[model samples]
Structure formats: C-alpha cells, structure tokens
Target chain A: MSTFGLWHYWVVIVLMMIGLYTVIARDNLVKKVMGLNLFQVSVIMFYVSMGKVEGGTAPIIPEQASGPVVYSNPLPHVLMLTAIVVGIATTAMALSLVVRIRETYGTTEEDEIRKLDRAEHE
Target chain B: MTFPIEAIVFLFLLATALAVTHLRDLFAAAMVFGVFSLLSAGLFTLMDAVDVAFTEAAVGAGISTVLILSTLALTDPREHQQPVRFAPVAVVLLVGAALVYGTLDMPYYGDPTAPIHKHVAPEYIEGAMTDFGIPNIVTNVLASYRGYDTLGETTVVLTATVGVMLLLGGLGGARHRGDAEVVEAAGDEEPTPMDRVQVARVSTTVLAPLIMLFGLYVQFHGDFGPGGGFQAGVIFASALILHGIVFGLSSLKRVVSPRFLEIGLAAGVLIYAGTGVASLFRDGTFLDYAVLDHHSAQHGRHLGILLVEAGVGITVTCAMVLIFFFFAGRRAAKSEEPGDRDRRVA
Candidate 1:
C-alpha cells in the first residue's frame, strides 16, 4: 500500500496508543474508563475507515437509480453498532465497579487502593 | 489526491483524546470526551455509516457523557497527581508499533476487492432486497441474516443491567427509601445546581416526549433508514435520563417505577428469544421469520424483524435506564455519609 493509503490506519494506531497509555498510566478509576472508551472508539474508527468506498455514498440503496451505485460496505457499520453498545454497557459496569471500590476503599486512586489492600493483608 | 474529510475529523479526534488524557479535572475530561464522540460520529457519517453515527451521537455523546458526569458526582473531580509512569508508555509504544505493522498487509481504504467485502458481505448486500424486501441492508442483516448475534447482544445488555441492579441493591429497596430522603440526598450529592434551573426543567419537559417519539420513529423506521432497536433503545433511555437529571431521581423513579423497569428489561429479552423459538415451532429454523406468514415469506421476515427489533429496543431501553438509576442511587447513598460529604466538598 502507498503512504497515502495507510495514513488513516496510522493515525488510528496513535489514538489507540494514547488511550491505552491513559488507561495504564492514570491513577484515577474514572480516567481509566475514559481511556478505555477512547480505545474502543478508535478501533471503531479503524473498522469504519476500512469500509469507506472511494466515491461511494451511504449504503442506503437509492430507490430510482438507473446504474449500479458505489456504496461503502455496511457490514462493518452493523458490527460497530454492536460494539458501540457493548462499549457503553461495559463502561457503565466499570463505573459501577469504581463506585463500589470507592465505597469499600474510600478512595478511587489505584495506588491508594493497592496500598489499602496491602495494609489489610499485612 | 484530494483531501478526505476523514483526515480532518481524525485530527480533531486525536486532539480531543489527548486533551481527555491530560486534563486533571475529570469533569472537563468527560466533556471533552463527549466532543470526541461527536467528532467520531461526524467521521462515521463521512464514512457513510449513518446508523453508527446516529448511535454514536446519541449513546456515546449523549448518554455516556451524562453517565460519566453523574459518576463524577459520586467521586472526586480532581485526579490525583502521579508521576509519569515509563513502563506503560513503553508498552503502549510497542503495541502501537505492532498494530501499525499489522495494518501494512491490510487492504487499502475503500478497496472494492478487500477481503471483508469479498466474503459474506456481498451476499447480504445483494440478497437483502430480494430475500427480505428491506431497503436498508444493515437492518436486514442484523435482524434477519444474523439474528442470532443480535439476540446474543440483547441478552448481554439485559445481563449488564441485572449486574447493575444487583450492585446498587434491588429496585424495591431503592424505592422504599421514600421521596424526602432521596430529595435531600440528591441536593447534597449533586455537584451542579443547573438541574434546579427553571430553564432546564422547562426545556426537558418540552423535549423528553419529543425525544421518545423520535426514538419510536427510529425503532420502526429501521427497515427504511439508518436506525433500529439498539439506537432506539438508547434514545428512549436518554429521554428518561434527561427527565431524571432535571426533575431529580425521586421524581423519575415515581414516574418510571424501578419494578416496571425490571420487568421491562426481562420482557425485552424474552420477546427477542421467544420470537426465535416461535419460528422453531413453526418448522422454521431459529430466528427464521419466513414461516411467520404462509402467504408471503417476505412478509414473515418483516414481521419477525419488527417483533425482534421491538424486543431489542425494550431490553436496551430498560437496561440503560436501570443502570442510570442504580448509579444515581448509589451516589445518593454515598453522599448521605456525614464525614464523606465534608471530604467530597473539599
């Protein structure tokens, strides 16, 4: 593939990395969830990008077209819709877990939670 | 080569992602993330994924942002100062490089001969109109050809809501707290006074019903347009969420009733699964709508899709609303702690 052909994927890669970095590096639980959201959304963008046809319009079949229409693939779009919903569901669950963790540990920072866990064990 | 709109959207998305990462205030991060979702929705539109864009706009930008902001109500808005961690950065770099390298072998953007397009996608695109007489191929494939996957997805949504309910305690338990305590707790817990504004109340009053109507349109119009059960469910949930935000959780619970929501959640999943089982008893395969109408198989498919879509819409809507209720309830309960409130205010 040419350089122009691959730039989109590369940008998505950078985005995914940023999200991953945030999730791993952030001490706050909510920030971690936000990072996870970003990661998943970047992946969605990658899939949607691949489905785009050069000169194609939206995949909805026109009612009165005399010739074959160039339409972007709809499969990825359908799949990504499921992914998006699942992402939200998972994020909701994660946030709830964070709430419970806060209730128990009295802190949302990962390092403090870890410290508290170690103290309890010791 | 001409510039594509995707590049511009991606740039904005990248900037937003970075801002979300660097912002110490969780509230600002959440808002920036909403902007990020909106940009991605715009990009999805540019990519000709209108349904996904509509969904991203509603669910990602609208509901998730609201949920995250509500979550911030329970937790501290300021992120703790931590030293930059090198290990995660190194790991991220390695993984990102691997992904980039992997993409080298992938088909170029919009290449008609890409492997994804060469496979069953073409079959669905060509067969959708002939088999189901649905103009929107995505809906046809989601509800008919790949009905089982959608069914599984509905179940997942139901399962998540159940998990949230368990985490936040039973619906009946939440209701028994009474309105007075809930009102007081909401007043104590909520970070924003905006919910109390007359303007917000009036606007939400005007908009909630219209939003629900649009949700219905999206639900039934899936056959002809870029919407279906999933989008409709989120939109419907967003309506209730808006009401809850402006009118307070107590009023919303009074209107929706947690017990009714719980029933709605299960009913949605059962409706979806039952449709498939019904098809089986009629000597058709699971989720086969062709047997629904003996006169015309197309009509059967249409009926089956509509019923199953309704089931999906119901479950998703109920699940989202239930989750929000539990989250908000938990926040109210947490804020009731006298000592915790002092620390939270600080």
Candidate 2:
C-alpha cells in the first residue's frame, strides 16, 4: 500500500481504457452500455480518490464544539451525489432508448441493428 | 494506520472495467460493466463520497444496466456493425488528453489545506454555523455562497424537461410506419392481458409511501448528512419511477400525469427564477436574499438557499423522469398497440 501513489492513478487510467474498449468493441448493445457505465464510474473514482486529506476524518459536525477535528473536504462528496443522480437519469434514458431499439430491430446485436438501419436508410 | 488499499482498489476497478469492455460476449460484457460500476462506487466511498457512491451503485450499476438491456431487446448482438469513424475519435482524444494534462500542474488531490478549501470554503463553513446556526457545511455552501448556481442548475432541469417533452410529444417519423406495430401485426396475440409490456414487480408496494417519506427526509437531511434538494429530487423521481416500473407505466400514468410533469417542470423552474428575482425587491443585490426578512442574515441565507434547492430538486427530478418517460413513452405507446406485441424482449 505504501506504493499507492503513481500506480493507483495509473491503474484507474488502465481500467478506464478497458471500459472504453468494451464500449467500442462490444457488439452487444447491453455490453456497450455496461462499458459506458464503467467509464463513468472510473471518473467518479478518480475524483473521489483525489479528495483524500492525509489525516482527514469524517465530514460530520460532532456534538462537542471547539474540539480540534481533522476532516476531509465534504464538497466533492456533495458534487458526487449530484453526479450520481445525473448518472441514474442517464441510465434510465439509455435503457429507454435501448428498449426502443429492441422494438424496432427485433434483436439487440449491434451489427444487425446497424445493417437494418443501413437497409432502411438505403 | 496500515497502508491504505484505496490505490489497489482503484487499480482493480480499472482492470475490471477494461476487461468488461473487452469481452466479446454481449451478456458477459454488460455484467462486467455493472461490476465495474460497483467497484468505482466503492472507490468513491473510500474517498469519503458516500452519497455519490450510493448513487453510482444504484444508478450506474442498477438503472443504467437495466436500460441498456431494454434497448438491446430491439437489436441483434452478432451482426457486424459499421465501425465508428476514426477522425472524430482522434480529435476527441486529442482534446481530452490536453485537458487532462493541463491538470498536472494543479495541486494534488485531497489537499484539504489547499488554497481552495482554506480560503473560501473554511470561511463559509465557519461563517454559516455562526451566521445561520446550521451545522451542515455542504448545505451552507450550496445554498448560500452559490445559491444562484443552484437556481441555475434547477433551470437546467426545467430546460431538459422542455427538451424531453418536445422529443416525446412530437408525432413524427414515418408516423404510420413505426416498426413496433409491424412486428406485432404478424404475431398471434398472447394471453395474460397486460404482460406484453414488461413492468417492474409490485410485491414491494408497501415500500412506496415509505420511499416518498424518505425522500422528504433526505431533502431535510441536508443539514447533516450528504443530501439536499438534488438527492431528494432524485429519490422522489426514483420512487415515482419505481412505481411506474413495478406497476407498469399505465398504472403510473394515472397518478403522475405527463401534463403534471410538464407543468411541474415549468412551474418549479419559474418559482426558482422568480425567487431570485424576488430577492431584488428587498432592495439588495440580485439574490441578495439577506434583506428578505427570514430571521437574520444567516436565517435568510439558509431559507433562501433551501427554497432554491427545493425548486432545483423538483425541476431536476421531474425533468429526469419526464425524459425517461419520453423515451419510455415511445415503447409504451408501441406496446399499447395490439400489433406491437412481437417486440416483447429483454
């Protein structure tokens, strides 16, 4: 764990790429969505992980006043909360779109849907 | 303390997501993505963003996955699709890379003693407590220091609502030629009445009201924990969506009317904008709510902020649900047609 600095950020970077790869390469629409979700989550982790204060405690105000309390910044957490909501809304919308796609194409395969779309366009 | 595992966890998450994306099998890929979302949420928790993580887990992993699956029902997984062109991708990558690299000179993450937290945030945290007697720091900052921003955020939701309504309400596209109807027309109608359109299960009906109550609690709970109008609005939307999902959209349509959603989005935004305008009447600065006569300057700040947040919550939640419905409505409308039954898929 002492070797956590450069390697940790690097790992997150790698994971983000993998998720992005899945989204790009996956032939399945569902899989593509999953990859996109992973990608979004990667960013969240990147932000949160960077928010650590060396000796920060929880961000709550305790009962005792005037006590010296070392705590992390609570703003990132708040920002993340909104992001999460946004993520959920995005998910719901994505799923709804997927459902529509499924209805039109009669299958969930990316290639087949594209082919059909092409045929329709042509 | 022992060595922190946050680094390792981050690495593992990154790996899982990469692996998930690389998988060939569509089903496995989606599941891996879900796990990736969960892991990232875990990372957020480690970083002290419990609320963000909670939402990531619930939405990123749960709702998003479900939606993707729904979309997959219409398309095939095996056919070879055209590759996305590389020119745009290259341009995007270059831009993104430049942006990330620019952050290198910035201070290290989580430096609580940085100029940002030190200069402005600490002042607000210390000031709000004595100023308004509220204990929550996030609430104070969001509502007071940046109350106007919160109002603007609410307006974004309202705008999204209008966008969604326009997207959903318009009757266009081969109006007489929706594919859903074509698929259904060929199939022999199945029994079980309303089973054609998949709805979320209703066994947990008892929990519906509780969820609404909890939404209120979360709205008010911003004074302490990681909550406020935004979280509360999402929670409220989730409850409404849950009802729509489980009981079927038809069931939900009866209670949460589309008209109501539209009106609520518009009204919520107007109220928020109106409040900021109202503050001007007190003969102070724009959003200079200090003179609004709430209690003291602190009280005015708190009250003004909360009201705006509430407006934001209302607009955002309504807008989100409406947007989802706009998309869902298409499928829902198709499903209503007897000929659209053939598209029932996962």
Candidate 3:
C-alpha cells in the first residue's frame, strides 16, 4: 500500500468526526454552520481524491507528449463543479437565515433564541 | 515534489477550518473562512482540477466571504452560540459509521481499474477527438452530450442570483447600494482607500492582458486540455476581482454597470439555450448541433460546444460577481462602528 493511500482516508474520517463533534457540541448556530461547511468540504476532498489516477499529469496536456496518453478521470472535476456551486448557494442561504434569526430573536445563541421563541409563543 | 507541498496546503486548510469554528469574533471567523477557502483553492490546483480550483477560489474565498461578512453587518457581532446536544450527535455518528462501513468494497482512490472510467466517460474521451473537435472529455460532457446539464446549471446561477437579490431586499437599500442612511451608521470594519492593495503598475500592465488572454485561451483551448466553461468563468471573474481589489471598485463599476451585469447574465443563458434551439430547428435534439453543419460532424459539434461553453462562462462569471456585491457591500458600508447606536434591525 502506498503511504498516501493508507493515511488519506483515515485523516478524512478523523476530521469528519471532529467536524461532527463541533457541530453537535457547539452552542452557537454559526458554529454548527461552520461544522457543516467543514463536513461538506471533506466530502468534496473524498470525491476529488477518488478521481486521481496513479502517475497522472496535472490534467494539462504536455505539448511534447504524443498520442494516446494516460490521464486521471475528469469526471470528479466535473462533479466538483456542481458541488462548488451548491456550496456557495448553501452558504448564502445559511447566512441569510442567520441574518433573519439575529433580526427576529435579537440573539444568535441557540438556547437563547429558543427561550425568546417560547416567550413569544407563550 | 508534491508530497511536502500538498501536505502543507492540506494541513493549513484543515487548521483554518478549525480556527473558523473556534473563533469567538464573527469577523475574525469570517476572515479565517476566507483563508480556508483560498487554501482549498490551492488544494484543488494541486489535484489538477483547475476549473474547480478557480470556482472555489472565487465563490468560496471571494464571494462566500463577502456573503458571510455582509450577514454579519446586518446582525449582531457577538451572540451566544448553541451547545451540541449529545443525543443528536450519537444518531448522526451512527448513520455516518454505517455509510463508511458500507464502502469497504469500494475502489481505492485513483485506482485505474475503477468503475467510473469503465462507464460513459472513457467513450466520451476516446471518441471526442473524432466525434467533436474538443480534446477535453469533461468539456465534451458539459458542453455537448450533457449540454442540457450546463443549461440547467446556468439556470442555477440565475436562481441563486434571484435568491440573493430577494434575500437582500432587491440588492439596493437593505444591504449597501442606494442606502445612504446605512453607511452613516455602519461600523469601523471598512478598510480605508489607502488600505487597498494596488497591483504594481508595471506588473498589471504586463499581467492584465496576459490574464485576459489566458482566460480566452482556456475558453478556446479546452479543445485539447483539461478546461471548460466552469474554469473559464472563474478565470474571467478572478481577473476582474483581482483588478477590482487592486484598482478599487469605482473604476471597475464604471467599466461594468449593474444594468450591463444584468444583461450579461441573461445574454449568456440565452446563447446557451439558443444553440440548442438552432439544433432543434435542424431537426436534431435540443443541443444536437451536428446538423448545424452536417458536412463536418466533429466541427459542427465543436462549434456548438464553443458557443455553449462561452455562454456558461459568461453567465457564471457575471452572476458570481453580483453575488460578491450582495455579500461584500455590507462590510464596505461602515466608515465607523456604531456600538452605542440603538438601531433595532428587523
């Protein structure tokens, strides 16, 4: 097994767990969004890594290389194009929601907002 | 050669993300997020996905940072964050554990014998040179066989544009532009005009044209390499963004007004769909450009892809810039902090 191959997945897994920990344990709503962003990037990393081919060039064709050259699959890059767009959309939506929450509840703290909401409902 | 470089970039991105979550100050966290986004862009370049790197750099580092910071401007800088409930954590972990464990039979990263290459992609790559003049298989898929996907994605850009516009209350008063009252009350976070980083006059003179030429080169040269609409759009957007940061927004805005931007957005989508309509009139499918010039099947397809890819790049770049305004305008408004001001925002 190559060294990078052995370690990359494990590192991703550990980082994912840490992201989950941050998301679930954090009291702030923004931190949850931050954790969520971290989690999504890990997935992007996994997909991109999966598309890598052994001994692949930088996907930019060398002028001197002749016909029928080997290349890494370009599908993941295609797939990542969609993911990157979606990431921005989600971040915009999340921030918008944060703005709304701050405007309405006067506190971005999850527990505090819940209390304020309860007071309103009660 | 790549071992140390990749490791450092990866480590720095991971650290920046961690710092983003842990920072108490919202502005600080947002700035760190920008750093994370740029590192991720560097990582994408390292992975040989140049298009993705560009989008990530523009949208992630450039646009998304602006969005988050603007949201900060409208809301409180300091607020208590919620605690993680243990119950939800356990359930989420259980689900994730199941997903990972189920992947034991999956192909290892970059394995040549993987199922992905065995499917539709290889045919597109192998046949593109003969069937369509473009050498890049991904471009072929995006602009030809799956031209419809690109069309849909263009609509996605418009949809985000509409969403951001609506969220910002039509992009005029609630945020930055058209709101003179806002600028007066906004805080000290705005960097001074002198703080603006100018591209060296000589280097910009040399590099600006080169950057524009390269963007065109990538747009046209996708015929032989790993580039397409997505990368080209980012290259175009980044060139402007780089110029904007260095030279200032006033000059950039003069070159491309809001009305021009809106028209650019629609025009790109129209050309993309228009190509499909031309094919339809030729009695082929929506994006079937083969009949447009039946004498040379590959050349016809090439023309179709070139037009569509150019359109995609146009819409995406413009939409991305507009989105950046929706975000960054918030941080730009404040000449001074109104900590004592009683502005009960709703």
| Best model number under lDDT | 1
DockQ of 2: 0.39
* Model 2 chain B worst lDDT run, 10 consecutive residues: B182-191
Task: Write the number of the candidate with greater TM-score, choosing between 1 and 3.
Answer: 1
Off by over 4 Å in 2: A1-3, A22-34, A90-122, B1-5, B24-29, B74-109, B112-119, B172-202, B335-346
- Taking the tens digit of each residue's C-alpha lDDT, what string does model 1 give over B1-346? 2255667778888999999999998999888988999898988888889988988988985789878987888777899888888999999999998998999898888777888787888788888788988888889888888888888888888887777665555234544553335444665555355565888888989999999999999999988988999999999999998888887777787788777888999999899899999999999999999998999999999999999999989988988888888777667766576464232231
Q: TM-score of each candidate?
A: 0.93, 0.77, 0.81
Interface RMSD (Cα, Å) for model 2: 4.5
Model 3 lDDT, full chain set: 0.67
Top DockQ: which candidate number?
A: 1
Q: Tell me the whole-model lDDT of each prediction, alpha carbons only.
A: 0.84, 0.60, 0.67
Model 2, C-alpha of B236: deviation from truth (Å): 2.1
Chain B of candidate 2 achieves a TM-score of 0.77
Q: Candidate 1: misplaced stretches above 4 Å?
A: B170-196, B339-346
Candidate 2 lDDT by residue in tens digits, B67-150: 444444334444344465575456546644664565555555655556556655566656656876666666766666676656
What C-alpha lDDT, on a 0 to 100 scale, does residue B158 get in candidate 2?
Answer: 61
Order of the predicted models by lDDT, top scorer first: 1, 3, 2
Q: What is the per-residue lDDT of model 3 for residues A64-88, given as tens digits with 9 covering 90 to 100?
A: 7677676666677777776777666
Give residue B234's error in model 3 in angstroms.
3.1
Which CAPRI quality tier does the interface of model 2 achieve?
Answer: acceptable
